[model samples]
Structures are given as structure tokens and as C-alpha cells.
Target: MKIAIVVKEHIETKGGLERYAVTLSRGLTARGHEVHVYANRWDVDESLIFHYVPCVKWLNLLKVITFPANARKHLAKSSFDLVYSLTPLYPVDIYRVGEGIHADVLRARFPNPLKRFLKRLTPKHRSILAIEKRLFTKGNYRAIITNSKLVKERLNQVYDVPFQDIEVIYNGYDDKLFNTNTRAYRGNLRDTYGIGDKEKVLLFASNDFKRKGLVYLLEAIAFLNRRDIRVRLMVVGKGKTAQYKRIAERLGILSQVIFAGAVTDIERY
Candidate 1:
């Protein structure tokens, strides 16, 4: 079977969605399917065929729009038994919306009515919403896959996509990289970071630190500092850690907060 996987970023990119695409493509290839990946910018993998979609780098919105547009055009020129899109692309056999609905995020995160209204009015936000609506409504995708029940509910609540049409498919990770076998590295990792054996370690890992509530985590660590129990937080993943570092400093838990940055090997800690 010939299959095409569509995503904005390269499968080799370090993120939940990228990992999913890589894993899915590898799995499909192992099962005797020829997999082709379509992306705007990608880290190359020899096992799968890659089709690049040209887009302007400066205009973020244009970049988002161009990838799908080019990918669709490419798809029209080519033929595949199955077209699976991780993004909200039109006319795909399957749409896997691992990234939750942007509408829901806007509404939940920004409680201020004025802010929400203004944010919705933005070009990027409007474009995302429009594409999502089309993907759910007129695209006629055979199936809509979500990473969690919350995502499924969000789809139903936001776009009125039928609950029956949304299938909850959880993300997969490297089990070997996140297993009990990594226990040996725990002490070494802690010691290397100057963490005492008695100190409790809290791990917060996310590429987008702000969205993942890094500030909230630091505040929690602050409150926990008041207690007799010693606690330390190891922050992993990419983002401007300087702001979070200031936050930790302000909370007087700077020593306790270790900004580990983006780590490829997660299970080691």
C-alpha cells in the first residue's frame, strides 16, 4: 500500500506530533506500506520519501497556509492509497488532530472577553479556526483522530464534529527511553545537578514552556518551599527559560529550579 503522511514540520523534529508521525510512518513501513511524508521543512530520513512544500519564512501565517496548499497540489499530481494528515488539511482520508483545537485553547486560556475577541480577530487565529472548521465540516475526511478524550470533546464542543466520528488515539513514545531501566541514571542525574538525595524532584517537560504553565509550576514550587519538605523542579524542553528563571528567582526558589532545557533523552532523569 502507498500511504502519504502530511505534517507542517519534519518528522525528525522534536515534538509530540513529530514523534507520532515518525512512529506511524515507521510502523506503516514495517507493515509493507510505502510511506511518503509531505512537509515545509523537514529533517531528512532515508527510509521514507519526503516532498518539500515551499513557504515564506518571515510570514508565519503564510507559512502555515502554504504548506497545506502545496501539499494538496502535490497530492493532486500524485496518487496514494491513503492520505493521512496530522494537520487540519482538506481532502485527506484521515485527519489526526493531535494538537488540540485552537478555538478551545483561545477560549480556555484567555478568559477575558475582550482579549478573546481580539485574539480571534488575528489573521493567524482566524486562519487556524477556518482551516479546522473546513477539516471538520466540508473536508469529508473518512476519520478524525484525536490524542485524548479532552481533544475529542473539544472537537465536538467547538466544531460540532460528531463524537462518533472522532476516534481517540493516544500518542506513543520510546518505552525504552522512559522505562524503569532508567532508574540507574536517576541518582547520577540528581547528583550532577547538585540535587540532594532527600530532595523531592518535580519534572516539567514541554517544548512550549508558557503554554505548558511553567510559571504556575514555579509558583507551586514557591509554595512548597514554605513547607519543611525540600523539593526541586527540573524543567525540560525548549522555550525562553530566562523569564522562568526570573520567576524562580523572584519566588526565592532559584536554587531549587533547574532549567535542564530541551533534552532528547527524557527517561534519563
Candidate 2:
């Protein structure tokens, strides 16, 4: 079967979603499917075909609106058995909701009603919501794929999508690289960071620090410290460290937090 995978960017080493796109393309290709990826930008891979989806890179709103619009035009020129999209787009056979509902994210990020309202009024947010609404309500997809049950529930709550239409397929990892054998590096890693054997180390890894609740984690760590508990936070991701560093300093846990930015071998943590 010929398949088309749609995403904004397809860099394998970037975030989880990007990596998932790469892995899915490879897996499909390995199974004898003719896999083609449509993206604004992508790393070159010899195994699959690539189609450049032109996107306006100047503003967030333009970037959001143009990519899908242009992708649709490019995709229309080709015929494929399946169109699986990781991004929120229309006319897809399968839409994978890697990022949870945008409304739910706003609610979580900005709990105050006024703040949420203000955010919703922003051009990017408004565009995203509009696209998402059309996708879910108009049945743009034959089925929806979510990585978590939480996402599935939120999609149902926010968009009235039927529960049966959303399938929860959890993200997978390569067992050979991620299994217990990787624990052998634990001691060396701790030594490299000068973490004491008695100290408890909390690992937080994500490219999206704000959405992943790094601030909350730091606050929790500070609270632990106040109670005479010795804990170290090892943040391994590509997020900006300055703001989080200031936050840690304000919380008085600066010395306890270690920022190890963007590691490829995450299993070592």
C-alpha cells in the first residue's frame, strides 16, 4: 500500500512527535509500503520519498495557516492509499493527535478565565482552534489516533468526537536501547554530575518545558528541600534554560538542579 505521512517538520532527533513521524515512516517502509512524507522541513532519508510543503516562516499565525493549506495542494497532486497526519490537518485518512487538545492545553496553562480568553483571541490560537474544530467536527479523518487516554477523553469532551473513533496507541521505544541494560550507565552519569549516592535524582526530559510542567517540578523539589530532603533535578531537553534557571534560583534550588540540554542517548538518564 502507498502511504502519505504529513507533519510540519520531520527531524528525527528533535522532539517526540518529530521522532515518532520518522519512526512511523521507517516502520511502514520496512513493511513494503511506499511511504512518502510531506513536511515544511525534513532530514534526508533514503528509504522514503519526500515532498516539500511550503510554509510562511515569518509569523506563527502564517506558519500555522500556510503549511496545511500548501500541504493540501501538494498532496492533491499525488494519489496514495492512506494519508496519515501527525499534525492537525484536513482530509486525512488517519489523524494522530500527538499534541493534546489545544483547548485543554490552554485551560491547563492559563487557569484564569481572563487569561485563557485573551490567549484564545490571539491569531495563532484562533487559527489552531478553527482548524481543529473543522478537523474533528467535519469528520476530516476516518479515525483519530491519540497517544494517551487523557487526550482521547479531552477530544471527546471538547469536540464531541465519538470515543470509538479515537484509538489510544501509546508511544513506543526501541526495547534494545531502552531496556534494563542501560542502567549500567547510571553510576557513571551520577558521578559525572557529582550527585551523591544518598541524594535522590529526579529526571525531567522534554523539549517543551513549559507545557511539561518544569516549573511545578522545581516548586515540588523546593518543597522537598524545605523538609530536609536532598533531591537533585536533572533536566534533559532543548528548552531555554535561562528562565528556568532564574525560577530555580528564586525557589532557592539552583544548586540542586542540573540542566543537561538535548541529549540523544536519553536512556542513560
Candidate 3:
């Protein structure tokens, strides 16, 4: 069978979603299915065919709006047994909801009612919401796949997608890189960071610190400090640390938090 995967970017070391796309393509190819990846940017992988979907990069809203339109045009020119999309593209065979509902994300990111309303009015959010509504309400895909039940429930409640149409498949890790063998590096990693044996270490890893609630984690750490608990937070991800550093300082727990910017070998930490 010939399969096409549509995503904005396909880089294994970039992030979880990108890595998933790469892994899926490789797995399908290894199983004797011809796999083609459609993306605006991607690292060269010899095993799979690549099709570039051009999109504007100057503006965020334009980037969101153009990708699906461009990707659909490219997809229409090809014949594939399955069209599996990681990003929002209409009328695919399968649509994987890697990122949760945009509406729910906005609600969480902007707790203030007025701020949330203002954010919803933005062109990017509006365009995303419109696409999501069309995709879910119109049954654009044969089936919807969500990484978590929370997202599946939200899809049902917000877009009225039938429960039977959504399947929950949890995210998987690369066993080759993440298995027990990686545990051998744990002691060295702790030593490199000067983590004492007695100190409890908490790891918070995410590319988007704001959305993932790094501030909340820092607050919890500060609270623990006040109770005379010795804890060290090792943050491992690619996100701006200046604002969060100021936050830690304000909470008087700057010394306890270690911001380890993005590293490829995350499993060792």
C-alpha cells in the first residue's frame, strides 16, 4: 500500500510530534508500504519519499492558513491508499490530533475571560477554529485519532464528532533510544549537573514552556522550599528562560532550578 503523511515539519530530533511522524513513516516503510511525507521542511531521510508543501513564513496566521491549502494541492496530485495527517488537512483517510483542541488550548492559556475573548478574535486562532470546526463537524476524515482520552472527549463535546469515530492511541517512544540501557547514564547526568544523592530531582521537559505550565511547576517547587524540602528542578527543553528565570528569582528559588536548554539526548537526563 502507498501512504502519504502530511505534517508541517518532519525532523526526528525536533520534538515529540515530529519524531512521531518520522517514526511512523519509517515503520510503514519497513513494513513494505511505500511511505511519502509532505511537509514545508524536513530532514532528509533516504527511506521515505518527500514532497515539499510551500507556505508563507513571514506571518503566523499566513503560515497556519497556507500549509493545509498548499499540502492539499500537493496531495491531490498523488494517488495513495492512505492519507494520514498530523496537522489539520481536510478529507484525509486519518487525522491524528497530536495537538489538543485549539479552543481548549486558548481557554487554558488565557484564563482571563477578556484575554481569552481577545485571543479568539485573532486571525490565527479564528482560522484554526474554522478549520477544526469543518474537519470535525463535516467528517473530513474516515477516522480521528487522539493521543489522549481528554482530547477525544473534547472533540466529541465541542465539535460533536461521534464517539465511535475517535480512537485513543497514546504516544509511543523510540525503544532504541529510550529503553533501559539509557539508564546507565543517569548517574553521570546527575553528577554533571551537580545533583547530590540526597536531593530529589524533578524533570520538566517541553518545548513550549508557557503552554506546558512551567510556571506552575516552579511555584510548586517554591512551595516545597518553604516547607524545608530540598528539591532540584532540571528543566530540559527549548524555550525562553529569561522570563521563567525572573519568575524563579521572584519566588526566591532561583538556585534550586537548573535550566538545561534543549539537548538531543533527553532520555539520559
Best by TM-score: 3
The residue-level lDDT of candidate 2 at 208 comes to 85
Query: What TM-scores do the predictions have?
Result: 0.93, 0.95, 0.96
Instruction: Pull out the clashing pairs in model 1.
Output: none
lDDT of 2 at 222: 91
Tell me how candidate 3 scores on lDDT: 0.91
Worst 10 residues of 1 by lDDT: 10-19
Q: So what's the TM-score on candidate 1?
A: 0.93
- For model 2 the TM-score comes to 0.95
Q: Please state the error at residue 37 of candidate 1 in Å.
A: 0.6
**CA deviation > 4 Å runs, candidate 2:** none
Better of 2 and 3 by lDDT: 2
lDDT of each: 0.83, 0.92, 0.91
**Tens digits of per-residue lDDT for model 1 on 1-269?**
99999987864448778778888888898898999999876777788899887777788788668777888899898899999998778999999987578877786667699999999998988998888788889456888898899988878887888888889977777885678899899889978899888878899988877666788888887787688656889988888989889888999999888989887776687
Candidate 3 structure quality by residue, lDDT tens digits, 67-145: 9999999999989999999998898989999979998888778989999999999999999999988888655889999
Task: Indicate the worst ten consecutive residues by lDDT in candidate 3.
Answer: 132-141
* Best first by TM-score, ranked: 3, 2, 1
- lDDT sort, best first: 2, 3, 1
Q: Give the per-residue lDDT digits (tens) of candidate 2, residues 1-269.
A: 99999999999878899989999999999999999999988999999999999999999999999999999999999999999999989989999999788998888778899999999999999999999999997558899999999999888888999998999999999787779998799889989999987788899999988888999999999998889887899999999799999999999999999999998788789
Compare candidates 1 and 3 on lDDT and give the better one.
3
